[model samples]
Target: MSTHLNDGSLTPLYQQLMEEIKVGILNNEYVPGEKILSEMELSELYHVSRITVRRAIEELCTEGYLVKQQGKGTFVNPRKMSRKIEQIGDVMGFSEACRACGMVPGAKVLTVQRCPVRADEKRFFSLDSEENVLYLQRVRTADGEPIMIENSFFPYNAFKSLNPNELNDASLFKYLKNTFGRTPTSTSQTTLEIVRASTELATYLDIITGDPLFYMNAYFLDQNKEPLLIGRQYIVGSRFVFNF
Candidate 1:
């Protein structure tokens, strides 16, 4: 560690300290919720001033890489969340991804209604604007912690028989295949954007308005290449690092 941190290097000593501590935390050298060494101890360990160590810790806290308790020193954040579903896109639903990460997954169905497609949705589905569709608004959780808001739109005929109550704690992917004999064979397109959370999204995601969140729009196709559904998800960024 001393060999990598240089006094004459372009990077400030505090920045160097931040990087060093971040690596330790990310590598589990300092496990989540574990208190890091005190500033004086870090100063002695790194052969730097206490102020430098304090500054590093402060920056890490502000970045969501660490958290500080008033009288408890600083601790590694437990919410270094990661979800990687595929190479280019997270084709798997949120529940599956969370389970793969060793976290219990759950969902709360917020809204279920059959409604007419809006103009943009009609264009994407290649349907008449007056045609109705099945829409669902859901909140996804990992280990019972709310994580994202999922808004999905599907053609009515394909899922007309689906019971909204069945989705309270269910996986949409599994339900579709088991009940409708529908399987997603391919992803036609997906878009990613970094945006501040809207009020509604922030409320469901348990984040403050204007906080950074990931906005994703995905289009899935069935075996015959027929459009299956379109979904938009707002994922909180501070608690997650999207793997795919």
Candidate 2:
């Protein structure tokens, strides 16, 4: 069946269309791997031009709401993983969490460096402008499968001198607790929508351009309630499932 668009509201036709489609996905009215109506079908039903329908569908696909296969119709995402905010404390480590679920935990440490903090980084990590940050970039794997690509920042003053090997062998949170006697007492996170994987990310995570990627921004607090770290994780849709 074709989705509908109203002409009475002040909302732009495209936006109205997008919102309706988003609601359908969230409400489980349109399920994953299900094909959405074709542009011609939608145009005919909405009494709008095929271009209008095409634009709406294209935008949706770019925003990760839908996917299109050449010569095939657009379909909903086939793999959507649940990201539990409440489980941050118990299983903050991606590898560990995946392993607990019977998936192998694997990671590739892409970059590890101690760099001067950016203005935003300073604020996020609760550091002074002069303080540096230990930046760690890694792509985590589950059962030999790529799942998440992460770029995390830690206050250099807090961790003293963090070694590259430490992050590679064990969870960063575990290292902080065991080596420094400080653990994450709590965490705050935000998620944003982003599309188009970078070439580097695409190669590492094994996804193509225009593929869906979730941008997860997180802040971890220490036992003393001080901000311990700030990070961004780019998770592949296939490896993640977010459930409310």
Candidate 3:
């Protein structure tokens, strides 16, 4: 539905206006923790009385969809995760990192399964071209808020014997060691970048497209110093900070 308020509808003008603003919130036209247009601005745009706009916004605030910060205007209530700035050297799973920062960590798996290894994946794992790998893509959260998006590839054989339930709500590295007897001896390689979020990324991180993100790429190494898994992550820009 369009964001414009409909005056001809039987619904009260304030209710109609509320739906439009709510749609903007749901559509990321108003990002979490970002201020919405002032009452005057909204009233002018919707061609509604200022009293109608004010009542609609107040209802939104009472419904917990928005917050009014003193002197700062109304903001879409933030549901966010913030990882501290001291985690880069640990090279740990996000679950572990979140714990270290005193936040509850969770994962929402987008995809998880075994597949034929891509050429680059084979090179990373030093596998023959015929080998296959296990792939996992998840949105990581801290305290119920999306923190980062991760895509990882691991040698399928290393995980074939384990049940998915064993890893679902736990740290992947910890689960690998405890359930499958495989543990990375170290992590190698480091490449970091800041990139503009794409539409897909914006959906995952609950941010607007074109927002900046933090990117990191690394490889988990086996005891023999061979790559065990390849990990690439896009972290929400304002939600995470890493030590240099």
Best candidate per TM-score, number? 1
Q: Which stretches of candidate 3 lie over 4 Å from their true place?
A: 1-89
TM-score of each: 0.92, 0.63, 0.63
- Residue 147 shift from truth in candidate 1, angstroms: 0.2
Task: Give the Cα error of residue 162 in candidate 3, in Å.
Answer: 4.3
Per-candidate count of clashing residue pairs (backbone under 3 Å): 0, 8, 0
What is the TM-score of candidate 1?
A: 0.92
Badly placed stretches (over 4 Å) of model 2 are 1-81, 86-91
- Candidate 3 matches the true fold with a TM-score of 0.63
Candidate 1 per-residue C-alpha lDDT over 1-244 given as tens digits, one digit per residue, 9 for 90 to 100: 4524688989999999999988877676777888888888888888888888889999999988899888878888895677863333336667787877788888899998999888767876787876888999989888888888888899876677778788987888888888888866567888788999888788888889999988888888766777888888888888777775
RMSD in Å for candidate 1, one decimal? Answer: 2.0
- For candidate 1, the 10 contiguous residues with the lowest summed lDDT are 84-93
Per-residue C-alpha lDDT of model 2 across residues 131-186, encoded as one tens digit per residue: 89988898887767788888888888776577667766457667777888887766
Q: Is candidate 1 or candidate 2 better by TM-score?
A: 1
RMSD of each: 2.0, 6.0, 11.8
What order do candidates take by lDDT, descending?
1, 3, 2
